[model samples]
Target: MTPLLETRDVGKTFGSVVALRGVSMTVERGGVTCVLGDNGAGKSTLIKILSGVHAPDSGTYLVDGEPVRFGSPREALDRGIATVYQDLAMIPLMSVWRNFFLGSEPPARGPSRALGGFDVATAKRVAREELRRMGIDIRDVDQPVGTLSGGERQSVAIARAVHFGARVLILDEPTSALGVKQAGVVLRYIAQARDRGLGVVFITHNPHHAYPVGDRFLLLNRGAGLGEYGKADIGRDELTSLMAGGAELDELAHELRRTDTPS
Candidate 1:
């Protein structure tokens, strides 16, 4: 089968400042494509392009073998592309069920529909069911989202995307702010999402977080490509070294050695 999403020599620029150049990768269904980069390394730019927030200045962006030029994120969402940012886009004071159906609340039927309201029962039930499917257990659907742990909050976002039938899930630094255990918790959900056949674009600065769940890795530095590799083609140490631009470590070692030497 064809990849769910693919970019060929994709490039983007801000006025005279180039944000990305000649970068490319494929995101297949049931696969996790991890994009690793540091600040100003085009990670944000690439994600914005994928989520339809901005169009690339060069190269092609394809979805399911079709070239699509999405004018807005809503258009991307209509095409089954959902993005969950680092913040998870959740309201702290809202209930789990409320946040689950925040924007796309299910409409009621018959006379209730005439009253123009939501199907609260169905929403709560469905929210409970979906969370359970993702191995998330909430004490009460009425509990405020802020009351949930970081992992649970991220799980809720992932489940919401799944419930809405998102085909490709673009997660922007979902584990960035969490503790080790919490990050692992979120990673499990990401693996689950991949196993369920949704293409996942996981953007992160942590190679440790990305390596375990990532099937393929794409490294970006200074708005350019290092190379995309399958899991077998790379290792944890090498991935980290490359992300740090390889030789800076050697230079630092040399400098330290000189400093240690008697003058």
Candidate 2:
């Protein structure tokens, strides 16, 4: 089957700086594609291009085998591509239901609809249901989102995207800020999202976090791809080594050992 989303030989340049060069990856239904890279590895550039925040100066982007260049995030959303950023774009002080609906609230009926009122009842019910479906347990939808744990907040964002008909979910470093247990919880939710048949793009610097949940891995370094490998073709240790620049690390270790040796 054709991938839900695909990019081929994509590249971007900002002034004299090349943000990405010849990067390619694919997102398939019910699978997670992990983009592993450190800072300035062109991860952000790839995300922007995928989510329509910016266009690549080179190469083709396709959805279901048809080439498409989205003009804005809305266009991407219209195509069932949703991105949950690191900040999550949620209001801390707002109620869970409120944050879930945000700009896309269902209009209240009759006179209330004419008065620009939203269906609070429906929003609350659906938000709770969606969260439950994603295996996210919240005590109450009326409670302030700020009171939730970091993992819960990330799950909420994921659940929100899935609830809104997202076919391909792009998550930007969702586990980077949490403790080990909390990160595990978020990873579980990511697995849940993939099991539910949403193509997931998980961007992170941590290979350990990505390996267990990812079906495919795309390694990036200094705005270029190291390689793209399927889980069958790569092991966890190999993934980690590649992400850390294995040869470079080994050479550095040898140098350090030599320096510490007695004359």
Candidate 3:
């Protein structure tokens, strides 16, 4: 089957600095494609292009086998591509339902728009339904989003994206700031999204977090492609080593080791 989203020879640059070089990958429907990299490994650059925050300098970006060039983030969203950043983009003091409908609130019909700007009842109903679809249970939709745990917040973000006609979901470091148990919750929701036939691009520095949920892994190193591997082609340890720059780290550690001298 053809991938839901694919990038061919994608490259990005700013002034004289190349942030990404020939980065290519695919996000298949109902599958999780984890992009793994350490700091300065071009992960952010690649995702920015994919999420429509930045345009690629040279490449072909395809959505459903049709070529596309997104001029803005809203363009991507309109094409059913949603991005969930690490921040989650929720207002702490706002109710969960309000945050869910923040920018995309349902407009009131007929005249008297001033009296009925947003359909609060519909927002709450949709938010609860979406959360339930993702296996997330909230005691009340009227509570502030800040009251929810990190994992719960991430789940809500995912649910919101899914509800908003998102066919491909890009998650940026979803588990990086959570505890072990919380991270597990986020992973489960990722699986739920995939099960619902949405292509997921999971970005993270942690190999352990990706190995279990990812169907394919794209490794990046120093703003270049390290290569792509399927789950059967790579192990957890190998993924970790590659992300850490492989043999160079081992050699550097060996050279830095201090030998004990007998007195």
Candidate 4:
């Protein structure tokens, strides 16, 4: 079968500024395609194009080998693409189950159905079951989302996406804010999502975080692709070196040494 999502020579330009140029990569079912880039590497532009926040100025974006230009994020979601951004878009004060069924809540049954009330019982039951199925054991579905750890919060978002029939999950720097232990927790759930046959686009600047779980690595630097390599083709150290721009780092270190030298 065709890859779940793909971009061919995809590019985006904002007036005179080229945000991305000739960036290409593929996300396959049951695999993680890690997109590595630092601050201005055009990673944000690529994510926008993929999630329908913006369209590419050139090249093709295909879903399952069929080209598609999504008008809105809803269109992408309708096509089974779910994005879990860093902020997560969850209400801090809301309960876990409430946040899970936020916009797409089920209506109450029996006597309350005609009155158009929310179905609290079924929503709680389903949300609890789904979270548990994803191996996320929330202590209480009634607890405020803000009370959970960063890793737990990310897990909830991932579980929610999977429960909603998402075929592809795009995660935006999910581990950036967490500690080593918490980051490991998020990574585990990412692998969990992939194991369940969902194509995962793991966007991160940290090669260490990506290397372990990534099936493929696409490195980006200043709006261009360094290269795309399968896990077998690239080792962790090499991946880290490329991402850190080893040559540049070496030059900077040399300059610092020169400044500190005695005449």
Candidate 5:
């Protein structure tokens, strides 16, 4: 089977600074590809390239076995590539339905060819139905989105992307700010998206969170490729150690240890 998304020898640089180097990976349909890294790692850069925020300086991007270039985010969206950043991107003061249909509102039409514009009622009904399909039970679609929990907000964003026809979903640090239970809720939704046949690129620093849901893992350090491993080739502890800079961490811990002395 062809990968839903693939990057070959992808690299990005800013003036004299390199943000990514010869990075390559694939996200298959119905699978999760977890990109793990700590601060200053190239995880953000990789996602930007994938989501079309910035085109790679060199190398190729392929979607469904065809080469393509995304000049802007709209181009990526046109090709069914959607990204949900850490911020959830919802207007806190707006109603759930409003936020759901913010940029892509449905249109109202009569018999004539040039008949209509934003259909508020239809948008609300469709938003409610989409959320319901994802098993998200909202008390009131008219309530402010800020009224929902962090997890619920994230789930709403996911459902919005899926509803808008996102074939490849890139989630950037989705669980970084949530409590354990809330994070679990988001993870379940990630799995739900995967099960529904969307290629998921889950960018996170937490291995424990990634292990259970991820089908493949790509490790990065300091703008360079560390390695990419499948579930069968890696374990949680190994992933953690690599992200933490294994030997460097061990050396620091050893040097900081206090010794007991006798006179």
Candidate 6:
């Protein structure tokens, strides 16, 4: 079977500056593809290309093994490629159910398309059911989304994406700002997405966070590909060191070594 999404030797440039070159990776259904990189490591460029915010200057982007060039994020969304950004694209004051169906509300039947016409009962049920399916137990769907914890908010976004027929879930720094417990909550939900057979692109700089959940690792440095490896081919320590700049860190450590004096 073809991968849910894959990019081949993708390259992007901003006039005189090169942002990405020869970067390639595949996101498979039922697995998490972790894109690991520090700042300025082409993560932003990759996300923009994947979400259709920008087009690659070179190479091909494919969905389901078929070449596709998305002119906008809406086009990507229409193709079942949904991105849940770090900000989550949610209103803090809105209730959980309201936020779930925010832009794409279930319209009432008939010819008249009233602005406020929505199937509230059905929406609430779906919102609740979808959250539950993702192992998120919100006390009440009517409660304001801001009242929930960070992890809960992330779960709400994930469930919302899944409910809207998202075949590929692109998560940007989902665990970056959460506490240990809250981060764990989001990680479990990541696993939940994989179990549900959705191709997951987990973009983050935290190797410790990515190691446990990632099935494949794509390492990037200075806007170039380091390599991509399967879980068995790479371990946590190696992943962390590589992300932290292995030899660079060593040189810095040696340079900073304390000078000893005979006492």
TM-score of each: 0.98, 0.99, 0.94, 0.97, 0.94, 0.96
Worst ten in a row by lDDT for model 1? 241-250
Model 4 CA deviation exceeding 4 Å by range? none
Top candidate when judged by lDDT against the true structure: 2
RMSD to the true structure for each prediction, in A, is 0.9, 0.7, 1.8, 1.0, 2.1, 1.7
Runs of candidate 2 with Cα error greater than 4 angstroms are none
Where's the lowest-lDDT run of ten residues in candidate 5?
254-263
Candidate 5 lDDT score at position 113:
22
The clash count of every prediction, one per candidate, is: 0, 0, 0, 0, 0, 0
**Candidate 1, lDDT over the whole model:** 0.94
lDDT of 1 by residue, 1-263 (tens): 99999999999989899999999999999999999999989999999999999998889999999988889999999889999998888999999999999988899988989898999999999999999998888999999999999999999999999889999999999999999999999999999999889999999999999999999999999999899999999999999999887799889999999999999
Which stretch of 10 consecutive residues in model 3 shows the poorest summed lDDT? 254-263
Over the stretch 1-263, how does candidate 3's per-residue lDDT look in tens digits?
98999998888999999999888899999999999998899999888888889989998899889988899999998889999999888999999999888888997755745776877777899899889989999899999999999999999999999998999999999999999999999999999999999999999999999999999999988788888899999999999998887799988777667334334
Model 1, runs deviating above 4 Å:
none
**Local accuracy by lDDT, each model:** 0.94, 0.96, 0.91, 0.95, 0.91, 0.93
Task: Rank the candidate models, highest TM-score first.
Answer: 2, 1, 4, 6, 3, 5
Where does candidate 2 clash, by residue pair? none
Query: What does candidate 2's lDDT look like per residue over 30-74, in tens digits?
Result: 999999999989999999999999989999999999999999999
Per-residue lDDT value at 145 in model 4: 95
Pairs that collide in candidate 3 are: none
Off by over 4 Å in 6: 109-116, 258-263
Task: Tell me the lDDT of candidate 2.
Answer: 0.96
Best by TM-score: 2
Q: Which ranges in model 5 have alpha carbons more than 4 Å from their true place?
A: 109-117, 258-263
Please give the distance, in angstroms, between residue 98's alpha carbon in candidate 2 and its true position after superposition: 0.4
